[model samples]
Target: MFLQNNEIRDLLNQVADLLEIRDDNPFRVRAYREAARVIEQMTEPVASLVKANKDLSQYRGIGRDLAAKIREIVETGGLEQLRRLRQELPVSLLDLMQVPSLGPKKTAQLYKHLGVASLEDLERAARRGQIADLSGFGEKSQQHIIESLGRVKKSGEKRLLWSDAAVHARALEEYLMDIEGVRRVRVAGSFRRGEETVGDLDVLVTCGRDREKDVMEAFVSFEGVKNILSHGKTKSSVILRPGLQVDLRIVAQVSYGAALHYFTGSRAHNIAVRKLAQDKGYKINEYGVYQGEKRVAGKTEKEVYASVGLTYIPPELRENMGEIQAAADNRLPALLKRSDIRGDLHCHTRRTDGHGSLEEMAHGAIAMGYQYLAVTEHSQKVAMAGGLNEKQVLQYMKKIDAINEKFSGFRLLKGMEVDILADGRLDLADSVLAQLDLVVCSVHYQQRMDEKKQTERIIRAMDNPYCHILGHPTARLINTRDPMEIDLEKIILAAKDRGVILELNAQPDRLDLPSSYCKMAAESGVRIAVSTDAHSVENLELMENGIAAARRGWLTRNDVVNTRSLSELLRLLRRP
Candidate 1:
């Protein structure tokens, strides 16, 4: 019955969604939403606080009422208010909100106007040309809905982002590790490979044969399990309530490594490895490596790889993408680690839409051992985020200087996340931009431009002498928004020529300059910056996601700009 942070956060988010659909007080809805964000970003589990009878109101956005509700949820595993809201509203209504471009207000409109209560209902209305007649939804919006529905249907089972999958994976791992006789547990497959999205979780455990029943029983009876698909002595499958399928298999210690390798495969990688094993007169399978019916290697992944005549390949690089050859040649680049990062180049504060103030953000960065942190507030073009104008930015510069004067060792880089307008002009004046430590330019609007124009627009923005980095190059929000159409190869080449760093935005949703592009940039000799475009101090932790993406791209520490010391980084940022 233990509730993890994600579970508690999800419950709060559900409450917020229901409140929004009910058209309840905006403040109340926002309170729930804010509380959800706070809990989601918190490093500690709220359940522990409840267990200690500590007041949750000490945290931001959690008031007395919300704190009491959190305590209630932690104690009882349910909220009466959320239960009542569920009763009042059809659960399918919440599903509609998942459709791209369908907010609660628009969903309410569709419901009232066309009786659209589900994705199916909305799809029918869009196809029948009924949604366009609604107040806010136009013909284009209707078409978008239809197209989005098609994507949803095509995507099959919903996939969770790595960040989300990690939560469930860790929770299940913890649960299984606590069971008796469990010797070893590992979450394999794409989750272990560090893929951005995961469709299902594959858990492998090594334990005594007698403990198989106990393990299977415990797994199927997990607190978050919504349905048990199958149960057997050695294998079991269950669907967690969050719509993620988890398959657990109990294996013998002797075959644990082989099973791990087999389950952690990108099919292509496994096939190549098997072919290599066959060439050496050895057979590789889930059970073990066999040479003339004798088990030669299996107890360790390194043993399996050695039997195949290659060094052990890290899971992240086991994609059969030249990794075998690289391993054979002993030319694999050292992958970047979380410890390699020295600073974050792009972050926000209360100066813009960020939740925390400059001081709070700076101290948070200091805690992370960052020698420098950039204050990259949005430019004036992004009005929705309360972006700053030239005059305002100048005033903010003075404040940054004052803050910098307070510390001798730590440096707060003066920077702005300037917008690259439709015509590719920088949002802030060059005079204003030149005065800062660095500039992070991005496209905030007009993302639907054609490939040529979009590529040219970005390239032109990079042409600016003051532009240091391109923020969220694709401007994608995973599962919600598609990346802008652009000639990425041309942009990468342009970035290489212009000395502009491509940002691997660490905002879980927008891990832009994605692995593929990051690889391209690195191969072309363009150093990338893995930055957390964090709005809150808590969000600074997202740097881990950026580093994961970088590793997936096969980037070395030398390929990242922020991995350098402050002086080295400053030299790199300086224009020729």
Candidate 2:
């Protein structure tokens, strides 16, 4: 089996943990760790090289000894040394290293001194105060460890949602752009492509040399800056909020666009272009491309694209997702626009788990230039979140009516995020569903079913007339969880046939109908509803990711639900 990058990284970490316990070659351990980091940054699947019997040594940091062993494992499915290590120490011991506060050395110490093998056992020992009594485990550390363990239960997924990242990025940009001497700034990397969790935040800025120093100083002094990792005239790295690394690079005003294009990329996009340039007898580097001693493209990104014989690819389309192919064919998809969105159909208020009030949410949508807004509060099944029962739903609708009466210019549509129960039934009764202006059916539980069952369950839910849109279908949290087991092709087709809209959930963390799936849905003639699924006024802005992801799938304004005017949207909703 081809190992995923995560699997390889996990194994390397396990090796490091084993090395720490044995006090083996420190350099060997360091090599494995470095190799893991390098592999993590590699865009191409490394396991394919292993499977193909390609030289693993070709990758940087993978020296001969390690490369041979990697190939051996690929050929035999196990490393002799790793197996021996597992025999001496239970492989389950590796789980201790995954705790938030614990690293390899700490895990080794725990295994050696406290006999802790897993987070569960560690938590049990800590709660009983046994951990506090151990050598090196002080009371404060023990308390902190216990709290970290408690946090494990609350860990829904490992990564942040992509929509959330964009929201944070925009907020950061707005904050930075207004600062003195700070010129243009753009968020780069997977976050730009709308990936849920980003490893780091890459911001590119261009300013004259006179203002560069102060801009750098201001960034490092920003409120969210916890620590400055590096600071220079042109580039700086800082640990921002929640310990996320924010790397800001400054470029000359002339090269601002080129630098933004280079920095704001999925590594795959950069690599593909670099290789293309190489094949064309040009050297493409961070500064610019050169043909021998001559500078061919350096002033702007547009020139760089022009040098490569293609139109400038938008940062959003820099995923190597047919951009090169389209460039080769001299064709680029007409990306979706903000104007294509007519209204947001799923929003929440303080009546549920939302931060804003109903009136505030509606007005926020209006401020976004939306023609209509749907207040989709949680259903009664999610009682913990102040979900609405049938009576509460009716009351909320009445409140919406009163709000609509008072608020003009934008229409307020009453809706409910009806929970898709474990057995595939919507939380609300048919009567309650029928009473709503629109129903967003979503799987709120039992997301771990087998593929066949999940597909059948979702298809059954799609059959419900009140189910106008399937919310966050597959229930993926971007980089964290795998998209749930539903057969997406079947789900898309069924939704299309039933006149059900597949939601392009803009919650960044759950851009559930991904660009790839959205493209497929579009090709299948399935209508898409791009929704923010916003729980707060600020979150209403997440519709941008929805628009971007849809564009990646080649969706235009007309292909998206909200792109329609209120009358057009209502006409489509009125069908079947």
Candidate 3:
């Protein structure tokens, strides 16, 4: 039984969430949560280490107690303590956390004070006027809860981040390839199309006909499968531990390409392609493309495209969004690739809320082959991050300059994620801003400003000569909060007019500058800075997510600023 790191991490997080719900020791809960984060970030499999008898305690956050808990989970697929805690706390209480703005602390208060055990219970309490009377949750809080319940129900079928799904998909790929007769395995569907959130994973496989039953059996036994939905000789499906449902289909190698094309679809894209095939006197399906009762093209995806007289479309562009026409016109974009990114422009250091020191982040950038790294710490407007004042910013700039002298072929660009004050003025003065390599201004607070005010506020910041880019432009958190009401199109126009770049934040929850808006920016001739907004060394790896998001937006090398060499990038940031 092999468990992926994310699988282990998710189970650990469950324990943490449970502990916090019951008002357990804060340090104890943090330990489990930290251990989970360490495991999730690990490239190596925790299950493999346990099998090898390696001491998991060697990992930074995993202590003796945490290591023992991990061992129990690895050996038995669950932590005994988590099961026991669920019994005492009414596991359904955890479900209450799904409501927007309703956190564990609030949930605990609700449960303790009102016997609220589920979403239904909470709704009843709020509707009965009991919640508004409670401490902390006044009329507005009760109203917000009432408003958010519908969203919770509508979004009940939880989705996994594409990155998380990829981890499981890769594990499944290795597992299937190890089978005696498996020929090829590829996870299709939105995963291939690189949607930010995936409803489920669809894996297509090709294998020896004689081994079809064996493949199906092995798939069901996949280590992370939480429940087996079905089992058959040629097809099977299972729900993984983290609530991601995966389906497996064994096909002959002859139809692999056709099956893959059909599976890796936006539905609308597939429909568009079928229309093309029909017009070409061909019928395309999962089996093969038929030419009036004769098989014509099916061996490869490129062949599938050629049969219809079109170039092969990359999966990221298969959104039925002018891609087919673009392919016919030979206008498909040369989309951005991971290798195109040369530096991370929006990194934070220990000077603020980040866990990494200047030297540590510089080394991490070096490890990732980055030519430069912009240490963009928050300004004083964000008091929670211990945002830096002018004095602190000046001190950090000197540190960056000193640090740069020590490393050849690497530079630490002094930058700040300055706040765009509610009235549209920058938080920092030009005296300090002029001393930095770049300035990334963002709206960290007052996110709920009316659309007109929000739009004007960001546009006003773009007018600042020192502002090089806008960070997480829309301020939306995936599955948690909706995007700010700022007119992204207006912002894009302003960025183009003022030479400000827009950021594609790579954080899993905040893949802001959603691909659609990114497309808007690119088409307007505004460059994007695909920064990880990394707080720690490990967070820099999130550039992969940003690159994926960038490609989805039809961005290319020339469309991104950081893709340039250090000299070229510095030249670009030079303001008029």
lDDT agreement with native, every candidate: 0.90, 0.77, 0.89
Q: Could you report the Cα RMSD, in angstroms, for every candidate shown?
A: 2.4, 17.4, 2.6
Tens-place lDDT digits, model 1, residues 419-511:
999989999999999999999999989887778999999999999999999999998888867788898999999888888899999877788
> In model 3, how large is the Cα lDDT of residue 13?
82
Candidate 2: regions farther than 4 A off: 1-183, 210-223, 391-399, 478-482
The list of candidate 1 runs beyond 4 A from truth reads: 21-25, 132-141, 209-214
Clashing pairs in 2: 161-508, 161-509, 162-196, 162-508, 163-508, 340-563, 342-562
Residue 347 of candidate 1: its Cα lDDT? Answer: 92
Give residue 551's error in model 1 in angstroms: 1.1
The C-alpha local distance difference test score for the whole of candidate 2 amounts to 0.77
**Clash count in backbone of candidate 2:** 7
Tens digits of lDDT, candidate 2, 1-576 = 544454465567667778877678888888887666555435355668876778877765678888887666556655787878988886767656445446667777777877888878798888888877776667866887887666655763344445434445665687789877776888877777655467678888876678888888888887557789999988899975444678888877666656766777778998898888888898776677789988778678888887777787877778787888788787886778887677998888878777678877887888899899988999988887789989889987888898898866788998999998877788889997887778999987777677999899898988888889999997976443456767898898898889999898886557778878888898799888889988666678778777877866778776788888888887888647
User: In candidate 1, what residue range of length 10 has the lowest lDDT sum?
Assistant: 97-106
Tell me the lDDT of model 3 at 570: 96
Candidate 2 displacement at residue 488 in angstroms: 1.7
Native-to-model Cα distance after best TM-score fit, residue 396 in candidate 3, in Å = 2.1
